[model samples]
Target: MTTLKTESPFIALSGVSKTYRTGNESLPIFTNLDMTIQGGDFVAVMGPSGSGKSTLLNLLAGIDHADTGDIQIAGQRLDHMGEAARAAWRAHHLGIVFQFYNLLPMLTAAENVELPLLLKPIPASVRRERVAKVLDLVGLGGRGKQNPTRMSGGQQQRVSIARAIVADPSLLLCDEPTGDLDRKSADDVLAMLGYLNRELGKTIVMVTHDPEAANAANRTLHLDKGVFVENEQVAA
Candidate 1:
């Protein structure tokens, strides 16, 4: 397995906390949590409902900020970055896969994957080539012209994966990616994720409730009420 250099942290969180307030009620999800994820690491986060797994994922992705603590990714301090800067950073460095396959119905598979690259200044020819390469990598090369509605759930999710990785982001964040799929479809997606980690040396952090999904990762971390409670290393 490829490993990150010991001196650099791909993702780090220190003393992180999140709280919500409503009608004089205060809810504290987790407190004093610290984590460091290195490049090329495939880590899974698992917990029961309301355990703050989703919150942690959001914080790492820069969708939400912690009440107190620090977050740094790929040498950038996300906690201090402006919203626009964070968004730009995410666009260029992170690939996100949500639980639902959020494909644009009006766009074909290739077009959906090409959306990210559209933000860059690359020539049209180069962008198209990159799109085709990633689509082929995800095993959807010939299906590029098909509308997502015509595809199976598994195929649509593969297109979503293709879209996420089209920019060749170094970090891949998946939030319950297989939650809506059947066992076979889930397995297919997991296989693709594993392949991405092994073949592309991408750092992956997935939030999932399924033990089987967690098993696919190289390491598993348990989050409880916004705190990281356990870390387990899976055998290769």
Candidate 2:
């Protein structure tokens, strides 16, 4: 297991708040939340339904904006960045893995992994090289030609992970990445995430409900009523 390093935080949130509004009702998700995650640390966030777990991930990914306070990611202010700038920053600085594998059915695994690189001005040769490398890293080197519909749930999720990291993003945000997998497959995914954190030194924030999944991370934090309630350190 990797040691926890908090000398400098890679992600920080200060006094942040988020709310959803209906016709006449305002639903508050997070109120004055504060958190910090160190670089290269694997953190598991466990929470019940509607505890703002997903909302927290969205805020970190810059998919959703906060109503108040500051969100700093890799020394940049996500809370203050403009929409276009934030989208651009997110593309290069962070990668997200979803609960369901979000691969396009019509595209091959390699093609799907190449989507993020398409946003950059990288050369086609370099893009293909990156796509091939990440696929191989995720244990799907030869399966790159296969389509999503032809792969199993685990393989699909691995492909999704390949896509997320193909750009070599510094931070990885996973939202129930193994939620739809069997035990063995979930373990495989969790192990891969651990490798990414330990070997590659990529900072990871994963939200999961399974205690087994939480155990995979070095640090586990429980959230309830929009606030963190528990912080447990897992043994190596």
Candidate 3:
């Protein structure tokens, strides 16, 4: 694992631009956008539907390439790395939690959490240990043997979070993590995220439409038309 100094800016995007081309019509998402995020900080991003919030998350995840500019995370230049290299970097340094709880129907919760480790050269015993530990951390220690299809929406989302953190990634990117859950379930999930951020010191950038969800983070940034219109520290 790569140990990084937490005092510095863990993520930086400078003069970044991204656009999509479809049949000669250009759709611009971000232009000359710059942002920085400190390590071990939890930030929530809010924006309208077309404000490029999720696009920014995708850019940070290295799932999409920016048309221009430097994208650095943990002192690694993502804009300069090739697709395969970026994939390798993402596997080690990042974990992603999706809104829809993307769990495989064929696997149990434990098996799903163990998927990320399968790409590594870890021993079976170590993989099993990590999966169990993460599942327990997410309060799903007893649900490891259950299929996701048999679980509640909140339970499945917790399983998704377990899978994301099982690899011990330094950064976590969540996209509308509680969008599909009930009010109580959403609170539970948000509380868990806060716990992870506070206890594990995970650097988090969460894209959320719910103001209540954004309040869970220590800082909140509102994006409008690819620009950050407001940045505020949430009241403790």
The C-alpha RMSD in Å for every predicted model, in order, reads 1.9, 2.4, 1.5
Model 2 off-target regions past 4 Å? 1-6
Count of clashing pairs, candidate 1:
0
> How many residue pairs collide in each prediction?
0, 0, 0
Whose TM-score is higher: candidate 1's or candidate 3's?
3
CA lDDT, every prediction? 0.88, 0.90, 0.91
Displacement of the residue 60 alpha carbon in candidate 2, Å = 0.3
Predicted structure 2: lDDT: 0.90
lDDT against true structure, model 1: 0.88
Question: lDDT rank, highest first?
Answer: 3, 2, 1
Q: Which 10 consecutive positions of candidate 3 have the poorest summed lDDT?
A: 1-10
* Minimal lDDT window, size 10, model 2: 1-10
Candidate 3 Cα misplacement greater than 4 A, ranges = 1-5
lDDT of 1 by residue, 137-212 (tens): 8888888999989999889899999998988788889999999999999999999999999888889999999999
Best by lDDT: 3
- Per-residue error for 135 in candidate 1, Å, reads 0.9
**TM-score against truth, every candidate:** 0.95, 0.95, 0.96
